[model samples]
Target: MPYQIQSYFLEIKKANLQKLRKDIWSDTPVPAILQVGDTRNNIAICYRGSYTREFRKRSYMVKFMEPNTFSDAHVIHLNAEYRDPSLFRNKLSLDFFQDLGVLSPESHHVNLIRNGSLKGVYLQLESVDEIFLKKRGLPLGPIFYAVGNGANFSLYKKGKRKKSLTSGYTKAFGNESDDKYLIELVKQVNNTPLTDFPRIIFKLIDIEKYARWLAGAVCTMNNDGFTHNYALYRNSKTGLFELIPWDYDATWGRKVSGGIMEVDYVPIGGKKTNHLSFLLLQVPEFRTLYRNILEEILETKFTVPYLTNKITSLHQTLRPHILRDPYKKKEIELFDGETEVIFQFIHDRSAYLKKRLKYLKS
Candidate 1:
């Protein structure tokens, strides 16, 4: 139902496209216009992501501007979802997170046309900014994006110092002049001993809510969310930090970045270094809580029946457009086959986790 609603148009100058590709990594935005549902507004467009931007079909970050904008949103993201052969990875993951009560960006599939040529299907994600907080009735506190591959929340390696930890995040909203709270939190997380980790985590983060978010990520097998491809926000109301997941095209059994992730793969950073989980798992109570949450998710949201139905419905909705997409890389059969893979993953992953957990408690 999401992809069926409307077709969005992005019109930009031909020269700007060349410039955007030339300096793909730059934060500089090229001026453009975005039209959605009979409403048009001025938008600044920029190529987004580190690895995905280098791909032929690029993702984008769009900032809505001008006095007569269509909506109150200051920014939005267009994910090319190039790595996802299924193309429904982001949509399904975000939807699951929201269903579990995580405050995340709302995603809708869009038929994107650039300069009158069909670009293909894109996922339009609601930006995680002040507007997003207001819409969800969440406190607009400091929001920082865990950008780059180096965005690991570790006490070792890149997170050896406070400056190193904060450097990995790009602060999008709230006070830019001071990052004392963020620095202090990082220091506490890294320097605090394992013995005191569980008690202290309650002060800095909402452990129960965060556990649900973590469960969703682990069940989906999103290797990117823990240390990178996430937005960390400090809630002004609760005064605790929370994580929002991003870039999930690599999930659901297939590695988008050219590696095969097994059903038994550890979700906390996968093969990467993750100090946060390393410390948390050291705490017995936290480990128990996480295991419980994972079990609950497997019985409910991550079940084969639930996910298979969801994937089947989405595949039906998207199949027609995908067949006609000019920028599509794979064949129609591959697109259709991906839904089966998703269904298989749900069953296989749930069974694998159940067996793993039997030994985990001992």
Candidate 2:
């Protein structure tokens, strides 16, 4: 008989979190070197998750890291044994998004096995965008901002230790009073540093554009989107914070939902009450920038049917991966109901925004 792996695997939560990392991986291993952030998994790191490394090969460097607090390399709430035909999904997401002209990283699939069977799966991604940034005249992160937008870069220090490394938004705009003793949070603004691209807020129109892109995308293929998950970073010289998306968990499939899951309420713009309008009001130069984004997105709007068709094609391709687990087999069925609700949601949202736009114009 094939070596039967238990449903529960080397999982981690609470105190054993570090131990779980030690269980399957080691700190000394060349791949686990973390570069930034205090939280474990969310921190950017070099991960070697693909085929074993050899000197002759292109080298073992995959950017599998995400900015999550949970530190889970693999997630399972659907009671699934492992992520479904996982390798192919990454490729599907990359190709589809890139083809759609959204900035995305290139990904490769690598078959993974544990205890002599395929128990765990992951993707090997090389951020060609990062490489492109280097090859092009622009520097990776800091220097690009410093030179292009006059933004400042700071090594966030805690006492003697440099705790975090972050770049973007201006330094001169903040004060010590912004740091609160109760919440312990110094209000954060995600943008290019030094340069005031309040206009970056205008890129919110892309949400609708992306919504339209996804309206069909969600219907044809079960998809999920969360706020702040869609990132916009403007190259100061370009005067554009290109709407780049990341963390495509519920993607490239036709998921069936009996009812709206918690993931359905996924809000954009973080815990804000009213997302787009609130953001426009908070940012200083929103009206002028939004006018520009609205014109562009509407001009090149990807229709519902077109998006649905593309996503449906993608879902068909990802069938093997989507059905790898028994639970995932049922999960795809759940998506059918979910998509109808999500579709109507965006429709209402678009009309509401249209009303808002009219009010603003008046």
Candidate 3:
């Protein structure tokens, strides 16, 4: 069974409330108090995400200052889930990755109330910060958030529309000096030839782990994952980086903005020169590994029957809260329609991948 859904109440001062509302346009943290059922704590709350924060019911990042907050975790994430009406995209994606033996942030559902007003149902996720790395026994190294529209993992210099690789990362942990490793990784990807890539790529990162992460993103049709909304961390023990998926509310055959994506849409950067997918797909061995990983996921973890049950359970659990949500962005009827769309997407996507498997091998 999935974890039990939780409800939280927040009491924000009028002045702090005003600051938070303004801070949505700009990324800033405001001091506030948080109440979980009966327990109270001092926390710093901040508006998080790019386009999603602009919405009325915003997503947030919370830092619990005092110890023993939420079982030794200091930071947690609350996602507004406006784009994904089903409200289970993040949970389902994270669960799928774990089933495939990949590490991802754990997530659960929560009801948020501010100043006695119901803000709607939000997805509460474990933050991937220093505390998270410690709990996972991952080495304390540089942690980078792949942020912004220019976060496309391509070696593009700062130009009219693109931000350079150096400027694209927001370091959450470790020293700024560690960025030299990141710079070297980007150079190798952009400058190396396909034949030479295999011999040298493993020295910079773990190819097997990366292939699994890439497979997860492609199989789920998460168009944004290749570029943005990921966390890259270097392991102090191995001195290699691993990828963690983030902000998956846009997945399951939908764009980040909730637009419909075709079931047959291939997320591989087919001809794009700079993106990682473009470079990786060019290698025959890597291509075969990606295809095999996709087959494993579609066969075992991401099957239609399995995902259908997930959508059904989460819908039933979130229905009441979603309907009564005071700050819901869309009508309840539309949300109902979205649930059906999600169901059909799972079934259709499975069939589509089964057919496309032959082409991938060819």
Best by TM-score: 1
How would you encode candidate 2's per-residue C-alpha lDDT over 1-362 as one tens digit per residue? 11112221221233433443444333232223222234333222222321222111112222333543222222111111123222233445555566555555454333333223443223444433434344355433311111111121222222232232222222211233321210111112333332443443333233434333333232223233322223333343443334444434344332322223333332222223213333443443544444444434323442344345544444454445445533344556643343444445434433433344443331
Ranking by TM-score: 1, 3, 2
Q: What value does the lDDT take at residue 11 in candidate 1?
A: 88
- Pairs in steric clash, model 1: none
**After superposing candidate 1, which stretches have Cα over 4 Å from the reference?**
1-5, 67-69, 158-163, 258-260, 267-272
Worst 10 contiguous positions by lDDT, candidate 1: 266-275
Location of the lowest summed lDDT over 10 successive residues in candidate 3? 266-275
Model 3: clashing residue pairs? Answer: none
> Estimated TM-score per prediction?
0.93, 0.44, 0.91
Task: Give a tens-digit lDDT track for model 3, residues 103-150.
Answer: 699888899988888888999888888888888887788888877545
Q: Model 1, 1-362: lDDT tens per residue?
A: 32373688888988998889788899799899988777788889899878787898888999878633445678888898886888888889988998887777888788888888888988888888888898888877999888854556654555344446576788878896537767777778778877788777779988877778777787888776767878888998888988888777788888867355788776432334656666666677777887887778778888877776778878888888887677673567878788778888888888878777654362
Evaluate model 2: give its TM-score: 0.44
lDDT of 1 at 14: 86
Q: After superposing candidate 3, which stretches have Cα over 4 Å from the reference?
A: 157-164, 268-274
Candidate 2: where is the Cα deviation over 4 Å?
Answer: 1-102, 107-111, 120-129, 135-139, 143-243, 248-285, 295-302, 330-332, 335-349, 359-362
Q: Which is the winner by lDDT between candidate 1 and candidate 2?
A: 1
